[model samples]
Target: MINSITQNALRALLYEVTTEPKPGLVDPGSPGPHSDMNIYTFIDSSLSLTQYFNDAVKIGQTFTGSDLTQMFFALRRKGLAAEKAMLAATHGVNTHKGAIFALGVFTCAESYCHTRHTELFTTIQAMCHGLVEHDLGHICSPQTAGEKEYAEYGYGGARAEAEQGYPIIEEIALPFLKDSTGTIQARLLDTLMKIATRAVDSNLIKRAGNIQVIDWLHEEAAAYLALGGYATDAGKQKLKQLNQECLEHNYSLGGCADLLIVTIFVGLERGYL
Candidate 1:
């Protein structure tokens, strides 16, 4: 089970990076807005986290405690090590930090769910209960980008998403991906844009230096979907235009990308992929 989950996790990581023409993200054809990392960097970073995923599954499998939050803490400790491994592999490029957090939580929750015969989302919510308050309730000084976003905008980012059991993935991305029709790349690209419509992408905000950019992003993504979303010529042109706009503004949909990764992991685990 651990090996299978780890393989899915790695596949999710690689799949997200390799999906073509993702606006403001690294792909095989372009690095989008990112000047530092590329597809090869993401591949190396993804490969380096194999052991971390293994440990996360093992933690979930062996945890016998009733308090699932305890299991979450154990996974977080492992996640720190995973982040270090990611940096070491990328030579300091932060390619998968958000993914490591979101996917680690899903990986751990999936393992626990399987062992206990519980539902996956419920297990994730139990593991991440009060996560935002616990992690960000007392903030005298902001360190990470998430902390800073919380202090400034009250946006909880990934923690809030997990604490709510990833409503975007549960309610939106998973269903859309399951019903989506296209080649694998087309399905993923459409799903990615669908996620972008709702995602309050902190990376986009950070790059644009304002939260207002989210509205524009939402509109652009919705318009792309309206034009048929990676299937129609108009939709493809919109994506190309969006990609160019993101590059020009140095924006990145990293939070949306992370959500896509988690969604893909869940989809694969549940046989929707």
Candidate 2:
């Protein structure tokens, strides 16, 4: 029997790689802000994490008692293994660090939902209670780019998003994705652009060292959306311009890029998109 959690986790990761014209993100059509990482790199990263996803599903499937802490620790073990696999696949490049965290949560949360026969969204949210303050909010030396950004800007990044079960995915990207009209690719492209205009991406801060950059990026995207945003001739030209600007600035809306996958995963699980 196929496990929905594992299937959906892989599907979400694949969706992240396959979606095209994702401005400031890696895609088969374009390499955004990265010379080494491409669609193939992401594919390799996904392949490396396959066993971790399966293990996550198994964690929830095999849980018996009421202690979610055990599941969290078990997930940590799998998460560490998955990180090692991702590093090996990318030759130490961080291709899907954000994807690993986001997808791992969904993978485990879906398994919990399936095993409990409960609704998924709430289950995922419940699984992530007190996530940030416990996991990433504690005092520690800033060792990573994201950690430095978090310490300075207080954006909360992926940890904050996970703490709330990713409200950005639940509220913004998913709605835009579900309600978008046209082909699936077109809809997702629109969703990606729409999402960029709404929130402060931690990756943007990590790259640009300011929260204002995210807002500026949002304004640019909002302007493009007003011009019909990848749905019309003018919008396509504008998108190209935006793509160049992202490359020139050496910044990627990678945080939004990561959440887009989670949004797609949620959409599939909820059966709307």
Candidate 3:
């Protein structure tokens, strides 16, 4: 079985690769089509090694998110950061434009993966791995059969949905603990609280729209923490404390996705997920 640990590791990998656009997947039917072709070629033409991580941190800095939306928000931040980094790295070749594409694809991958759709995830991951070797001369492992199948179908589904003007969050996003009356996953939620608190404290979320979503998630997390008391008083207190602290700091959404990841893993560990 694909346990939560493996799922999380896969999520982390998926998150990293998707932050960059998939090479060779651009719609020929779309716009001016790679007009300049230098950095564009490096991104739209093929994946690059600039997306890889070292010691679990992207290049050097760590990504923060404790919920799925928070995760997307963080990727959004990463995309912006990538643009700046690439600008600095390539002596201002406008490499950051490519970084925006990467972030778009990352959001795309996350939307698909959460919906149990693996197609985009597979293709993106494969391209990213290829980039690792081609651009960086570092060979990573080949993608598995499951990933391949996801790639084959995920694209078509995504395209069709886009044509219909549907939000991917409703159709493909990850499930949250508060989305249902289902049991609470204490350990995971707890970790998520910590991550969320850190993000808010760090001033990661500045946009009003993003802040609204994070605020909602904060309420959801509070509810989850309260529910977790069914398992143990200690769990309840820990969660309560986390929630209180988050409230004190003005609840940032940047870390929500990571918190969600932790919650899911904890639930799975406790047999709640």
- Return the top candidate by TM-score: 1
lDDT for each candidate structure: 0.94, 0.79, 0.35
Writing each residue's lDDT as its tens digit, candidate 3 over 80-181 gives: 655655565545554234324333444434444545444543423432332222322331432532222234322222222222222222222223333434
Candidate 1 structure quality by residue, lDDT tens digits, 21-103: 99999999999988899999999999999999999899888999999999999999999999999999999999999999999
**Which residue pairs come into collision in candidate 2?**
none
* lDDT tens digits, residue span 64-94, model 2: 7676656767787889889999999989988
Which of 2 and 3 is ahead in TM-score? 2
Candidates' RMSD to native: 1.0, 1.9, 19.6
Best candidate, lDDT = 1
Worst 10 residues of 2 by lDDT: 118-127
Pairs that collide in candidate 1 are none
- Please state the error at residue 273 of candidate 1 in Å: 2.0
